[model samples]
Target chain A: MKSTLIIVALLLMLGGCKSTGGPTLYQQLDGKAGIERLIDSFINQIARDEKIIHYFEDANITHFRDGFINHLCALTDGPCEYIGDDMVAIHTGMNINETDFNHVVELLINAMNELNINHTVQNKVLAKMAPLRAEIIEI
Target chain B: MSMLKFFLGFIACLLPFSNFAGQGKLLATPGVSQVEGSAGGGLVPWAQLAGYATDDEFAINGFCSRADVSDYTLDVCGAQINLFNRVEFSYAEQHFDVPALNTKIEQSITGAKIRLYGDIVYSQWPQLSLGVQHKSLRDGAVATLVGAEKTSGTDIYLAASKLHLGALAGYNWFWNMTTRYSEANQLGLLGYGGANSRQKLLFEGSTAIFLSRDIAVGIEYRQKSNNLGLGEEDWRDVFVAWMPNKYVSVTAAWLDLGSIAGADDQTGWYLSVTGYW
Candidate 1:
């Protein structure tokens, strides 16, 4: 096809971008199971402490958990729609202070350690979530 | 004993999901490189610079070392571990709410980008990627949002970056030009029957620079369309990152300045840490 040549020509012009050290070092991990297990690990880390989980007293654990997972999956361009609650609605009245939100974030790091996930994927997810800090913390 | 069992069992169950987005993945993004800092992107480039797909890697590996007028914020959290591979995907959610006024708002970002070969600096013949950061807004408190409530919109962008071998040479950059192609949900749009949404388009750009192998820096300037009525919006930051080891990275940044809704003009800080399996 003419388009194929254009594509090949473009690749030649741009150097056809290839890896230097070895074959691709990464692959798309399994979707659902991988994401849910991560959520559990993350939530459990936050739940162990009374400070952060305390805010969830009036909140439903399942609802909150599902929301967290869906939101994360959607953010990563996964094929899912986050449906539990609106971003602001869930955080409303919960009064998630910067400290609380941040502590949980710490727990999240620990969870990753326990899971032994690679460092690169970890940063990819965190980068996706960083921009939301302003709205979630209100501070 | 049951508690201990539960804890152990939990980790066991999660072990299989090892490769998902965990601490290690977060460690790579430039800004917020650490888990306990206040700076958003002091030493890294913004996530937007990654060109939508969260896993795009240009040919450069260095820390960003820049300061935002508000706080030194690094943006590049990281490049994908998959090499300069093919693929792209991204999504975002924006929220607007005024508790006192009992109003609410929301927005979504859907992005996808693919790499273009050859380096920005051409040393390693870095990869280049083109993507879009679409913004979809829905709200009910537009008038009270402290600024214009451009309901829904999306932006297209082109990004090119490179990675150098050592301490002295490297640079990364990303630019986004989004058009306001949807409704400007006024946050109070309680279904005003049939109000037509306006057509307002805007252009914005962001860039990141590297100063050393483990340290990097950058800044972003976004020119808002005249539609928002806020004239122009600015977000500038500089950050420093410490990659003691590839397994972990710590970053701190100072971000100063403003946005559409407005910041206190106060300096802000961010700390981040990322690691992997």
Candidate 2:
């Protein structure tokens, strides 16, 4: 009986580990069109957020949008490769603090919520984006 | 009187409505309230501070937890405050009811935590914190009869926690490790020390994978010192926490507390609810 219980517990743990067996995140996010929509929503929300909007005052909206979409696509294992400059190079002079970085993340979260993105998918994206804090936060 | 003091402090913290409000960055990163009134899992304290305090903000959190084991029932209620996202102060009232013996033991615990270094999500190094809990038994007579060494004791602990984003196929993973020096049996409800009165070092660890931005499932194991010789054993649990939003969160767990007061296999259901501002 004890061995059986141990086996059952192991099975439960294994079941939880199967999250990686599904489709790639790019496909799960509905490919290019979905990526485009997500980026559009995110950019719109960032524009409305006064906390971080000043950072984008001199940014070219159309160029930034395309570069961001391509960056996200490449990060999620999509077919497209990002052509823009690396994150560190682009954000080096921004003088972003932890508070500013967090504010942008909050806007991204709001955008994801508005797009009705699954919470798990949202976290997946955020997880990939989290490491960029070190590169982006200059101050 | 201690209980009254705890309640008064809780009420005072709640009265500062403007100071206790606002949200922080990240989801499911600042752990919820643990059973002992610290920010952590149900049984073990994690390194993260409680509430939604950002760099320049203060926040408050309140929680209640109940666990129904085979031989006893335990209830805990507490409130915690985060100061400038650096320090935390908490107070909790605990009651342990053993229906078979028709007896109850009450305890009041005051806890403080200081974030020494690192950020949970932003830093490469694990966030480290130092914590201390001062516990005093209200039912001193009953506790002494159970071979308890002292009615009051202090527990000191150091905890480290880290968040590894995209560690598991894009999912976020959280890990925590804590080292505690104490002689408390059953988390000071049955009092501190006893036959083996020497303080011992104990380890507690927790790891969780984010199923979503607002949901996490994890397991925790806490090693205990059997100082009282009442067959105290290690504690283990598998828990799932759901944070619907910043203001509210709930957790449910299947806990196995090994043994307590000679009652073996004390397994049960644990549930906790938390409200933050």
Candidate 3:
């Protein structure tokens, strides 16, 4: 029983440690320039990925680049507001399945690896973006 | 040997599907295969299916495991098919060497699992699954000598699993709980039931912390029933698994099975490898 209590206390401590007032995610990501570099790397990754490349064939690359960088900046609490199209509106009619969406996520992870992003920061970024799956897929 | 030929044939059969092989789930999301041929830790079945298939894809996996303890050694080989990440079918052949008895026992298990609801990572609730395993003993002399009632039995289980991203000190945490109803004695190697002959509810659990995206260290506990009036015991293990990619994984564990049949302190080392396609 004493061991069980210790385990429970440890779990409670771990559970309570979510996102306290340390460095903001934006600062940890090195601010706007870092996000832009990430987006450029992500775009390059998507370009090389054949499985999901066709989805961008008719896309406006410059517009997408700017919108995505702004989106990331806003998502990460950087000093930016995304005045772009909604995620649902942008992904509608593309019929992107879960496989393709996950493929894109993998490509982004590859990009992050190439940039030598810390694993913890990458997980935070993915967590911030994961909820958008509902808005972006199977619509 | 014939087993090698059969394994080669199995690979040949999978060749046709290689062009459309599905790896839809994130790497290492689908847990490694268990001893009973289910997607789980080395000892306990988790709620996840066996391969990297999502709702729109299918996957196949093959695995082999061996546990060598003080008085016994268990070798198992199996294959699993995951359809749409919703259902799984598996088959496993087990060979048990009982050095004390100067004999060997063999059993085959056929298993099926269905995902009832939720996703391990994306859902608010834990992923739930229902599963069944039908075990048949190929050699029943030891079972009969132990006063077993039957050489075959079925186990039904309900399992729930969840993966918490960055939940444990910036690493991923995964946990699973399974409740099973069975009358199998020593996983049916000693056959099913006995004079006691009552089915009992059992509990199994596993928890793991992913040090990296590709590696996990975990512990598992499984409660067992002494249906045959033998001093069967609960099982526990500490395991480390490495999934370098979605296509392959390796696991090693130190097991403390307490006792089996009549032998006490049945501790061992276990190693397993799984290949996904």
TM of chain B, each:
0.51, 0.95, 0.95
DockQ of each: 0.02, 0.31, 0.50
lDDT of 1 by residue, A1-139 (tens): 2332353345344333433443222222247677788889987887788767777777778977788778877876678776767667666666665435645665776776678765445544554565576566542
- Name the better of 2 and 3 by DockQ: 3
Q: Write the per-residue lDDT of candidate 3 for residues B1-277, one digit (tens) a residue.
A: 2443475477668769876767999999999999988899998888999999998888888999999998999999988888899999888889999888788898888899999998897777899999999998887888999989899999999999998876765677888889999988888899988887665999888888888889999788888888888888888888999999989999999998888888899998999999999
Estimate, for each residue in B145-215, the C-alpha lDDT of model 1 and write its tens digit: 43443444444544444432211211222222222222332211221112233343433333343443355
Residue A103 CA displacement from its true place in model 3, Å: 0.9
Quick one: best DockQ, which candidate?
A: 3
- Taken in order, the candidates have interface RMSDs of 13.6, 5.6, 2.3
Residue B4 local lDDT, model 3 = 35
Candidate 2 lDDT, B1-277, residue by residue in tens: 4664666576576666855354764666788888888898898888899888866777788899999999999999998888877998888888899999898888888899999998888787999999998999887887688898899999999999988765554567777889999889889888888996654899888877787778888888888988888888889889999998888999999999999989999999999999887
The Cα RMSD of model 2 versus the native structure comes to 3.9
TM-score of 3: 0.93
Point out where model 2 deviates above 4 Å. Answer: A1-34, A73-100, A113-121, B1-20, B197-199
Off by over 4 Å in 3: A1-9, B1-11, B196-199
Ranking by DockQ: 3, 2, 1
